[model samples]
Target: MAYSSGGRLPFESASKLGHLNVIESEWVQSLLKDFETNDVDNADNYENDIWESFDPSSVQSLNHIWAADGSYVSVEENHKELAFVKTALMTVEQGKIAAIDKEYPHPLKLQEIMKDSALFHATVFPLRNLKSDKGNIYDTVRHVIYDSMRTDENGQYFETLKWLAYKKWDGQKNNSLSFECPHCSKVIETGIPYDQDTGICPHCHKEVLLTDMIGFHLDMNEENASDSVASHYMLIMEMLMLFTVIRLQWANKDTTLISDTLFIKDGPMTLNGQYSKLVPNIREFLNFAKNKERPIHIIGSEKSGSFFEYLSLSSRFVKPDPGIIKYAVLNHDYIRRVIQRAPDRGNPYGLRTNWGEKVFVYLDENTHMVLNMTTGGYDRSDAYPKSSDIIGLQRILATLPALVSRKYEGALYPIELVNGIASMSNYPSAKILQDFVRDAVH
Candidate 1:
């Protein structure tokens, strides 16, 4: 009865409400009274030295503000599921808009400037519903992913997106991607096949696809594997697309554009799980670019999380003069002891995956930023990341004023724009997608 044209039944309604009666009973409540969890409230304890203040230095405009975001929706029907993943890389020239528009610009002037602003692309891969798809689920997934990366948006994004992974944005070429073989556990390095191409594992002779390098296939199984693979696919797509944008900014040999542009990824600059293998490649590319004297500026802004919540709470203390900037580098010890309440022993935070350290910036009492930022590639050291390594924190912070958006609290314009491009409404979007897949199969 709860179904709304999405399918046979809403999954939530499948669970009967009869269990609530037992949970509401006094005897059941008494049995559950001893459980406890971490305190969600913030502590007032002092860490006075970590906080730093600076005079907001005036900086030149960023020539292009580029942001990347992605979304994926899974459609399931009659014991089968498929995922539709969509990602967008949107770019707008903040400097040009201000130079051309008047003090109170007309609506059409703004519209005309933004008419050609975004590059959007979408692709599909097999999930639970792979039986009817062209080939083996894993092989089909690899083919689709490879083609997705090769997307060409007219002439604007002519290069294959996979070129970011398969080759390099600024270095020597490697046509093959490598990973530990799932069957034999030996490292298998080879090129992805064209059409139904498959790599033969040298150690065990197990056939592998190029997409296996990322490890989404590890989470996949014959039973109800749609969501896990879909989520992983969405995240990897977002990271790859962001780097693809960075590659585009490189423009083959015109590297100065990299310095003049600002890249904003929707979430933290970290890739987790088996997907984390991409982190080293990212750090390597950033370092390679830096060694060549081309450092790109990128920031990841968080809107809803423990970190963002802490920023909202801590911003109460940051009331500075008109020109002063207040910020705190959330070092590992502070994060371990305070934010996460984890035992100080063990590995450094994000030792395997994070390319940037967390830094909380306060623009004003009303504008607080919880940022994951880094430059000169990802930190590779075992020791705590130093403040100096965050190469352009001050410069990037100075440019924030021109990019802030009033639509959301502490939101930046480019991220807000990409969110709009990537966000999909569930009611209409899911239902429509489900209908389309259903029609296509018939």
Candidate 2:
């Protein structure tokens, strides 16, 4: 029988088959074993000694809010070799979609079917190389993405990642975010680490492959390439979306119409892979936005995770203040107790990619409560730093609860709007992109 662990069950249970239930239990056990082997018990480390608590009394009024999200799918044809990847980027402002970007990268085999359609003009992606390699599509897609990152909406190229990396590396006292050698697993730094494009790891004295350090594995076969491509597209969308926000704020600083606007993203503020090394640059970008006429309240809210699961359990015990919103930073002890399992006896919280402090916001009694938050703050070197702006974080906490869905426990209204517009399906987004190209060309 499905019973409520916390006053009421968080979700309704679906009818379960006995065999499926057995399979699920076995899969969970396997996952627990894998977690123990990885030593995830000691994975979370908080830099601060004391987690600051805040009392949120009131929320600031905001005029505009912007949220962005992306979705993608891979469609393999009858032959299984030829595939098409359809990706969509949607941005919403004030509960309406402000922009949309859609792209379909298909194999040359699709050209015959899509005769002269405008959709296939530059959409015919090459899968083979001059030597007729089978998986050259990866390089072609990478090149297109790289070019897009450098180019603006007007098709003009500018220095972005490389320049930002060089600037940040030049200013940093030590390269804390340096790539580890694949051969030695030791961090290495070059004389001009950012300018070289690529380098050899000093520890191993071997060439460093960007693909290894970056989470996205570029050298994988076509079947696995879809994941890498999707991740790349999402990351690019995030970067561009942020760039647009900053640009708009910069241009409209003098006018009150754009000032005091809040930008919300669907996930954590931290970027992963080689892109993660640019955290310092992102901090600088935030600083640039803040220096304008009115402060830009940019923050991210996560809807799901093990962290949120634990937060839900921990919430049942706390009695919150109604007049004042309460919050605390997540320390090592709290995180370990809540998230760690058996066999993890060590005390290293191994969260390095995230630079912000993880905080818990207790918003009122039971309309819905507890936001797992990370705040952007002043930290030049360490990827995850202890020092965060409590006031700024409090501002975010205050503003967010007002935006939460009244009927849903963990969803924000802005994110829900963008998800409805950007989410993909096999029937609509993926199938439509594929069918249209084939139908138009034929």
Candidate 3:
């Protein structure tokens, strides 16, 4: 059962498991009662002091702050030193502080901060002893006062522990969406809000579903907390990709940035075993891209899951005939190549060699084919087919000008021919080949 911010009670009254029933009904109620009592006491104190010390001017500013968990260093003789450094940014209004935000380095670092002796626990005694010489004067306070107020120590440790526990609870929860569409030659951005669906593209107008989008709640727990963060990160990446795509469409009209741009998911792109929810969402975005004739590129980190398998499965849904879409399992070596080559030329999207030659087309390069997946993928794949199989497909497509022309068949004859060649060479299932051919002809 879950509660919203508005304080609505969950419909399910009883927990299915007997052990949880006691914890949920009895133990939780007791804890809530205790919390309420403490709140009442705090409220009384606040009310009592409402006028005596409530000078608005003395309270310098109210700021929002965020903290990253911490880092660890192993010193000589097998000694480990845990150092927790939190980054705080102040958003000030005129002269007052407005907001501060913090994020944990990684979920695991929270646990490390709690257990380590060198950081959190070491400052308690000194903090407790700190006091101002002139207690009532705020300006007279020294560094010790700031240190005591700024550092959490025990609270940080406990908060980290609580976050880890909440993460555990979140892991059991599931959420995601999915869709289907033809493969386009351009890069497509899916998961667009329905309100923003209409487009000026010559091929289609009003291309997205207004009501198809849904919000999902994820369970939080210790074991899968990291996984949850990774999933959220992927969602953010997808959003960023959409932003980049939109920027290309209306703002920049650049193809090279879209083509050469690489998005890195902190973990593998695989959706784990929870496919029913996640896959459909991914499919929906891909389908939208196909309709828009856009190529979508994604890469996952070393910690990525079965993303390759998922991509392989998703590839089947893409009509091979259009030859608009292709995906690859990019490992660390591939990512390293992109990073290394980014520095040499005046532009990042120039001629850079990875496993083979790769031309980084900027956002402006080849504007006509910038968002077209079939043409762009073919062009890029032709330049840098990561594997021999992809290279062979490109070679076959390159031969199509001799067999066909740009007359009645559309400018996509080359793409269709390439798909046919790929199907013939790869010998995929009959259903897949037939689908590919159908997509190509249509």
Candidate 4:
């Protein structure tokens, strides 16, 4: 007897139809309702007054240049959580990997590093113990979740919170950092209450975590598990890299080496997550570098953004001759047009997320070369602010053409080098982690 297929033919098969409509045309039309487009010709409106013209020769020769990037991966997925999370930090100098830090199986390994390293200090507790209602020792866990959001791989490590608690951590001694109430934003004059997850905010009259008050936000969306972890890993690693650079800067204080070097990162100089409050600290670092006399230029250059995308499509921009570069000193008025926003808060008057002043640069008319640049030390406010020193902006603009990547269009070589070195390929990371664990067991 021939066995007949028991359920619904095992599976239903359908012929592949090319270019099938994934979204309803009506929905597409609805999305287009708020879609606004302006004539590309308008880009020329401020080209003359805003564009800073520079020749290729004006680019400065630097003694040293460095860039950094970080990567994270979930090694194994369990029923309700990732079985293992792996993270790696890479720093490159002059197209060479100068430093690297990685964590596997446990993030606490990172905390140990931070605790022992003279370059860093732990301002906040990596883990805390909570007492039950009866005032009995309840349980303890890692500080992996913040403001009800699950953090990514090895999130339990507390070194990530040091930036937020730096203002309170005493050097050489791991002391509790003073924090404001999350609800009130009021400074808790008496230090964080003992054995309590939350404290009463005097100003707002609400219960809030003292740690959350430090660069933590309830408005941040952390619903996507993978995305959330990746964000934390990136932020923590970026800050750590900055710390490394800062230590270098401090070590060479008596020498001119640090001053001659330029520190560049792949993305904006800004940090996100619970560590965002550290931005002011980064700004201070910039100022400190500048005050040392011969300042080393540090900047964050983006390869893509909505503004960059629009600038690419705009044909009205005046192109520079071969080996020359053209740059625009972006203002609020011009930015609003390029980045469309709701009538309420979309105006380009102030910085929403980015800490650097938005700059648009064309590497050359000879190629499809465009770059987005941001420098540190500028005050982040909502109002349209001009670079106090236009000459400084011009000097930075002049440095780009020399750093352009010969391999990729619209890419910077240093950033490309660092990114390539830092990025962890899926296969390599998996193999490395697996082999590492296997060796450990053996």
Residue 77 alpha-carbon offset, candidate 3, angstroms: 30
lDDT of 1 at 386: 63
How well is each residue in 1-442 modelled by candidate 1, as lDDT tens digits? 1222322222223346335767566665443432222222324433434667777666665677778888888887887778887777666787754444233446786566556566566777667755644666755665566556544343222233344445545445565466777566687765443322347788898877556667766665433354667777777777765675666556534557678778888778777777887676677677777677777778888887878876676666555668777778777777777677788667778878888788887777677778888755544344356667775676677777777766678677777667777764331121111221233211
TM-score per candidate: 0.76, 0.57, 0.22, 0.57
Report the error of model 1 at residue 332, Å. 1.8
Q: Residue pairs in steric clash, candidate 1?
A: none
How does each model score on lDDT?
Answer: 0.64, 0.45, 0.24, 0.44
For residues 307-380, could you state the per-residue lDDT of candidate 2 as single tens digits?
Answer: 66665645544566666655666555555555554344552443445544456656655533333333334533
lDDT of 4 by residue, 1-442 (tens): 2223333221121113213463235654343332322333455533344565567484554545655555544433233223122323322233222221221213454333223111111111111132334322111111233422223223222333443334221133322345555444567565445434455665676765534544333332222233344455454555455444444344443456555565666665555544555555544444554565545555666666766565665524565567666666666665665454435464344343444556667765533343333344554344344554222455555555456666654566556644544543441221211222233211
| lDDT: the better of candidates 2 and 4 | 2
Positional deviation of residue 333's Cα in model 3 after best superposition, in angstroms: 24
Highest lDDT: give the candidate number: 1
- lDDT at 422 for candidate 2? 54
lDDT of 3 by residue, 220-307 (tens): 2211112232233223223222322222321223433232322222222323332222333343343344345443333222211232
Best by TM-score: 1
Model with the higher lDDT, candidate 1 or 2: 1
